[model samples]
Target: MPYEPLPDLATLSLAEIAALNDARKLPPVAQWNPQTSGDSLMTIRADGRWFHDGGEIRRPAMIRAFAGLLRREGDGRYWLVTPVEKQSIKVEDAAFIATDVAAQDGALAFKLNTDEIIVAGPDHPLVARGTAELPAIYLAVRNGCEARINRSTWLQLVELADADLTAASQGVRFALVPA
Candidate 1:
């Protein structure tokens, strides 16, 4: 007898296979945030997972007031992934020191020249360090001071970088920063 080929999965009707696929890849229902517009953000209740615009996932982490940056994908979508860990500090905190770059000896140093922050923690003295031009928020603990990076600010930075880099490098910048 001749071997038989399997049926094409794509050929199946939507109603016929929707239930089976949903069961296998079923994510928990999410609690929608009224503050966010459009279908960009989703909060899954099953595991407290947060899905951002560009399929970026965030867990239960304390996001800070002024850390990270946001970038837009070509498909009219935005991604919020921070280079540093998801903790941020207010710009006006007493412990916060704005400097050019972060150093091990410096508890909290902000690189005004580069627009970055360097922070230290108890367990790890050089806990977090990153530039202020990314699309995510961060939090750092240093000198008994807790710092937070704002998500909104991060998003704005991402948008700005995208435009400037695009024009200057003529698409070379896109290679440097991933979508």
Candidate 2:
């Protein structure tokens, strides 16, 4: 499928963003828990690159397809799940990376490495971690997965923040600096 570019994020209203998110139908991996489980030998590097048996998976379509099947279980494990089986996947850091960001209609819209757009709100909150000197910010994605906010995107958020280093989205205020 051809990837369609979204209209300028800054031009979208909060309701439009919500509607875009609501229209996406993800695979029901949560409902399809099979008894069969095994290692997929797939590793997601800390920088958000996908590799299988030490070989890079270069195709964006394949990566997006595999990303759609990802699930994080109660045991803090990542898996590529299907109705018939589940394959364990190793993740060095976050499963996704927030590659781009925009301040839209009093909300922050994020574009992930997989080209998925999400708005930060109660369901997808921004969390600050790491030390004050080396702060790491993360955004909660679906299925218990998170997207590490990359440096450039983080800077973009900073530019959008108030003097207190906080930003508001969907009536929720988020701290950019780790407490």
Q: Go through the candidates in order and give the clash count of each.
A: 30, 0
Model 1 weakest 10-residue run by lDDT: 167-176
TM-score of decoy 2: 0.93
Best by lDDT: 2
Residue 158 error, candidate 1, Å: 5.5
Model number with the top TM-score: 2
- What TM-score does each of the candidates earn? 0.17, 0.93
Instruction: Name the regions of candidate 2 deviating beyond 4 angstroms.
Output: 5-8
TM-score between candidate 1 and the true structure? 0.17
Query: lDDT, candidate 1, residue 129?
Result: 31
**What C-alpha RMSD separates each model from the true structure?**
21.0, 1.5
lDDT of 2 by residue, 14-124 (tens): 788778767767798878889999999999999999999999999988998899999998899999999999999999999999998988777789989987788899999
